[model samples]
Target: MSKTDVSKKALLSVNDLCMYFDSAGRRIKAAEHVSFEINEGEVFGLVGESGSGKSSIGKCIIGLNRATSGSISFHGTELTGIKSRREYTEKMRDIQMIFQDPMSSLNPKKQVGQIIRDALKIQHIGKDAKERDKMAADAFRRVGIPVEYADRYPRSFSGGQRQRIGIARALAGKPKLVIADECIAALDASVQAQIVNMINEIKKETGTAFLFISHDLSMVRFLSDRIGVLHLGYLLETGTAEEIFREPMHPYTRKLLGAIPRCQCRILLRAANHSVRLSATTLR
Candidate 1:
């Protein structure tokens, strides 16, 4: 039996979600019967290989892609039942997403500050323009970006900086749940560590729930409170991060853990044994 926590009030619940794509009369099952819940102030990590329907689930939750079957509920409200524009907008304000690619997600033409301000305005967050501007700068500062960098365009920033900017924009709306889809995948090793630290800090400070989707098992194990393992469009296992890593129930889950390099696996086991977070030093 899956060991996902059922004690807390679910912030976001997905039930039997199936996403299929039609191409040349053939049906592609992107996600099949995926079910999980993310509680308030919790991080639920989804781990899978490429083409394993991880991103597809994120997109479905954020309304980017409509699922073929099943239901999605946020705070007891069914997503598909929300038809009114006002209601949809209000709901979206409570849920946000950070995409995999920072450069592709951001507008190269707009200043970094403007990007954040736009989100604040769209969410109807601040009282006025000046307040919105201040919020944008604050968002930048929260993400460890200098306020001065706000004037620069996305093209001027490094990949890590751009990703931070994307995170700033996502948090500007003050969303309750953030779906971070492979958020650190595009960055270099050092930058990835920085981003991971930032994410953990942000989650602690803001009390926001996260659906952190990634292929990196080590990173997922470090970051997630609970974890779901996916393979071939199916959810194979669900458990606490410690449970999943130490005593993986599914064969696929074991296969994934076994694929880790021997040196890294040693570090992972050491960290797990000590009940410590995987540090940047050990990750290298």
Candidate 2:
């Protein structure tokens, strides 16, 4: 589809979604009445602390975990009671996930080329080994990996490079929606920036929608068109980055902003310290 067409479509929609677990004979709700919409070509950030149901919601949308009650519609089709393998495979082709830890997500024993080619083979896109190899190489190049490295194993590559491979795997299916769950958290700061930029470029080029789950508010502000804050399985607030940063309406959001180290008092203290240091240097 054209970029304009993608911009006009709502790729995924969730309504009153709830996921419950039966724990020790007591039912616990991991996600409670969560609802949101991710438009095609837009980045939606789901920010929350650990155990706030962020990953749970992602798993539900991806069909890894079953929802207790709620509706998830993808491309105008409801994702409930998908009975046939063909239907499931059709949905899988349109949606893919990039896991948090690259080291664990990839198979250590398999060659990087084989790992990436597996997705295409499963989807029946390529006819033979040679065709799959070419497809894998194309995906690797798209994610900035050198084609020669495709023969090496995941253990041979650095963390950042491994993450890039994971990204290439996710893109191999030509998915319309990518749920990136802490995709950059395991990398160093500099590497994280590089991967984030890569994701941005790919999103612009392919018009792929993203549901980015992270605790880094700064990164979320930079990448997301809209941000949602979750507190104990409840969506405390949802707004554009500017609105959430400048005029947070919820008490939880206000507390989060207040805790950020960029508050007025912290800035003033740093400025005062810098001024004192400069004065001492002048005296010397």
Please list the C-alpha lDDT of all candidates, in the order they appear.
0.87, 0.84
Clashes in model 2: which pairs? none
**Which whole-number lDDT from 0 to 100 does residue 6 have in model 2?**
46
Model 2 ranges with Cα > 4 A deviation:
1-7, 261-284
What candidate 1 gets wrong by more than 4 Å, as runs, is 1-7, 262-284
User: TM-scores of the models, in the given order?
Assistant: 0.89, 0.87
- Candidate number achieving the greatest TM-score relative to the actual structure: 1
Weakest ten-residue segment in model 1 by summed lDDT: 274-283
- For model 2, how does the per-residue alpha-carbon lDDT over 1-284 read when each residue is reduced to its tens digit? 22443457688999999899898999867789998888888888998766778988999998999988989999999896687878888777888899999999999999998998887888776779898888788889999999999989999999999999999999887789999999988889899999899988999999999999987777888898888998778888877777898999987676555444454887757655654554454346
Candidate 2: C-alpha RMSD after superposition: 8.1
